[model samples]
Target: MSEQFHAFQTEGEGTGSLVKRTVEDLPQGEVLIKVHYSGVNYKDGLALHKKAKIAKDYPMIPGIDLAGTVEHSDSPDFSKGQQVICTSYDLGTAHDGGYSQYARVPAAWVVSLPDNLSLKESMIIGTAGFTAALSIHRLEQNGLTPEDKPILVTGASGGVGSMAVDMLSGRGYHVTASTGRLEEEAYLKKLGAEEVVGREDVTPEKIRPLDKQKWAAAVDPTGGKVLAAILSNVKQHGSVAVSGLTAGVEVPTTVMPFILRGVDLLGIDSAYCPMPLRKEVWSRCAGSLKPRHMEETATEISLNGLQQALNDILESKIRGRVIVNLQK
Candidate 1:
């Protein structure tokens, strides 16, 4: 049965114009999903605006995370009507993504919807929340804990940063949220950040190799100079989980922090993480790392609302998450 769906497509030259299309038009994949919800992320916003080199092709659907039900599957592992979540692995970039009523994704990229999450809640967490959980997991595995010292989260107003604050704080770590939005100080504290500091608090005076150690661990979504500053301030033997280049990609710092202080720069790539580990991380997100205000951290929108959301995210005017309700 052919079904028409609304999608935000990035046509040539990085323009996102809404297009109404049918399921039959989607690329062939082992699984066909009826998308229930999707989430707006900075990358998705970039895709919408044709920035960040995220979309590999024009006329691409630009949502990196989706939650829905399996309509059909060539693979024996999944059945029709089974709920599922799909994110990353070329989605919304190399392939048509979740910004539609239906999506066809490779079976390899699909994850069974965990019981603790509904389709809507899954998208609420989306790729941003997943990245946050993975960062925390890696940091803990690297010997970080609440006792290590106060953990700092940069870009604390964004999705990944906000989720990281919630997760780290829930795990008993004292969280310092760094953001330029002083207006959200109470909001950050509501999300469990023990302290809310200005973005300038972490900005470095010089491109130093190392500085006075401050945090025991850090979760950084803003890369570039912010990441450099975070690395410089992390205590000896501390770890910093690095994700995203929202600020910029160039990290202008020396290896003094890494070599002398034994600082670990952990890179988080959620797209191609191993399936087993990915599932494990999802399980953690559904349980221990689940943000108490998962819904509070998100604002729900319809497909018609995406363009404005994209604009807000790109302008850094948005705080917390934005989930797209396809059914709306």
Candidate 2:
């Protein structure tokens, strides 16, 4: 008989409830991982909501990021007992994902765990941190440097925002973090934010076509009026790397920032990012870009606690990262 394990599967309802599964139940893949840790992300939160339409089908697992050791492999690139991580692509959305004791994924979707990073630590950084690193990487590619003026990170208390703030500051950039929760000001500062501002401060009543230039560049995970506002205020020749749309899908802005100031609004697509760039970013995350406050930014939970955590993430009640420990 195939081995049986517990997994969070969504059926014909709101968010899927937990159910018992087996190795034979997983989708087609070349790699089988003994999942150790997975991180909760805003995408995972939305995936649990049936009406959100983040999943391609029912009975799918919702974790977008997972790190563990290999149990079996059909490809020579990975061997049994090797540490690895799987994120992005179709793992959590269209395929069986990491919200389980075990997961089988395509070998192409996997990355060898970089040295100096533990499996738990990799999950702590997860997809959110990967997106954050990608944002910084894109900005730097467009000529952004630490000597430039204040670098803004919106949604400062959440996963991507928190990681960006910590990583940017650690790289010698002066970071200004913005959040709706003024109560988390000290927390943001603790993560290396040089300045913390209220969400309302960035979302002005009426965003002008060309507002006064403020930041040299920005890493924005909250797209909407906040993104519009940020674009309007970026310094001449500056760039903005946007990765999320939690604020809303619609962005009300104009060409003035782009045409007049030569501003660049770079879209960050963490999903389906080419494997070469994905591996490079993960390397940085495990190296110089790794957040110094990683442990402090993560809240560990067990499989039994996933439902509540997903609900909290959608309600914006979660702070920093939430890592699910399968062994627990």
Candidate 3:
């Protein structure tokens, strides 16, 4: 007989319900993880709300990231009792995911938890922080540096944006955090943003191919008009690493920014990132890219708390990250 655990599942459009099941119900995989913590992401919210195409199947667990200890493994690279973190690679969407107390996942999807982070702290960083680090890595690889100029972090009140703001500021770069939540100005400052401005402050009424070059680089987790505005205003040789499409997916912009100013727009997809580079990024995140007050940036919830947390995230009423402590 196998042990059973509680998991949140999406049964159909606009419906999410919790279900109890045995470990044997999970899909076949080489490693079995006793999931300690899982984080809520925008995609998780979408899965819960049935607003996006995040779930490929009905009755699916919807946590994209998890940190845990290995209970069993057939793969030589991983062994019992080892702490590990798993993100992306279809953990939540196409397959049973980490929302449950236990998750069975492929060994190839696992990364050894770095020494600098605890299981709880790993969930604090989660998918959002990982994406922020990846954005920074892509920007740096494209020749961005602190000395270039101020880097703008759009949607700075949210998870990815907040992490980007903290990481960029920690690296001694001038960070301008843009957010619609002006009431959170002090919070943004505490995250190391040198300047905090409203969303409209960066967005102009008119759309131009290029405008005054205000930012040398930008980390945009919000798409739609905010992204369009950034592309029009970025400085010469500047780069924008775009991740989320929270505002909207369609981007209406002109080529003048790229053609006239030598600007570059880099896309960051933390999911399905190659293994070697993913490991490297996670290692760096556990090191220098680790955000200050990581714990402060996250609020922990339990399986029972997931319903309301999911609602809060979908409505954009939640701040920072929300971690679900399965064991709690």
Candidate 4:
């Protein structure tokens, strides 16, 4: 019998289809992982649904987050049977990624799984969780603290936003979650949001360079108008850490907030983050920054269910994180 495994590959541009793949078909790498879990992110949704051109290569496998054990290794630093995680750094884009049952990744892109996090738990906290943790890390490094006034988390129902809410709130920060889906108010509160506001509350009818001071800081993933509004309302010397552009990239605002309020707009780039900082952030995610409501913040789906889950995420129907169980 042929030694084969299942993978979802895109032949051209649109949605990829599942097919059998042999080990030889994988990209060159030092470590080959028998992937146990992966996660669906917003970028995965856009790429899979053809809403955005995310994959740099046509025959791409679109899963930016993977966690499993090393089945084989050519690097002296890694040994077979060692658990690891590979995320970002071109995975699922310029390089083949974790959508398959097996993934061959450069040893440099892999991190030994933190002792406290399980494979399934790691995928639940995948890229989205990591982005959230990095955002908070940067903000705190810029002087944000739990004693400050409420921190507004935009797009609170989505994965990054939800994780931000949970993690920030877990650390004793006063969290005010804002979402277009007002019906999820109960859900956001459950994730530790002290307050839940409607999207319209955050996106004003007309944005000013500065507005009434509302939040001490903000974790904004939606970007665009929501970011513009948050910038206007952040208190003096506060910061806004932005990670995603789901609401579009344009920010139509002046520099009054930066000049007068001294607000810092910190950009978070989870992909290609220096390995040292990346490992530090991952360690924090497995430690102090880990979401207390993690189990409530994620749902598991099989590889076969990815197509629909991708569409749901793009349509803003997914709440929290969605993990892919390769064994299923």
> Which runs in model 4 stand beyond 4 Å of their true positions?
49-51
Give the Å shift of residue 134 in candidate 2: 0.5
All candidates' TM-scores? 0.97, 0.98, 0.98, 0.98
Total clashing pairs in model 3: 0
Query: What are the Cα lDDT values of the candidates?
Result: 0.89, 0.92, 0.89, 0.91
Instruction: State which candidate, 1 or 4, has the greater lDDT.
Output: 4
Residue 296 error, candidate 3, Å = 1.8
Worst 10 residues of 3 by lDDT: 46-55
Give the alpha carbon lDDT tens digit for every residue of 1-328 in model 1: 6657788777745457778899789998999999999998988878754456778878788899999999999999899999999999999989999998889989999999887888888877899999999999999999887888799999999999999998888989999999989899999999999999999999856756778889999999989899998888989999999988988999998889989999999999998989999999998988999888887799999988888898888889888999999888
Q: Model 4, range 111-226, lDDT digits (tens) per residue?
A: 99997999998999999999999999999999999999799999999999999999998899999999999999999999999999999999989998899999999999989988
Best by TM-score: 2
Local accuracy of candidate 2 as per-residue lDDT tens digits, 32-87: 99999999998887887668878888878879989999999999999999999999
Cα lDDT over the full model 3: 0.89
Cα lDDT tens digits, model 3, 139-236, are: 99999888987899999989899899888888888999999899999999999999999988988677666778899999999988889999988988
Model 1, stretches more than 4 Å misplaced? Answer: 12-14, 49-51
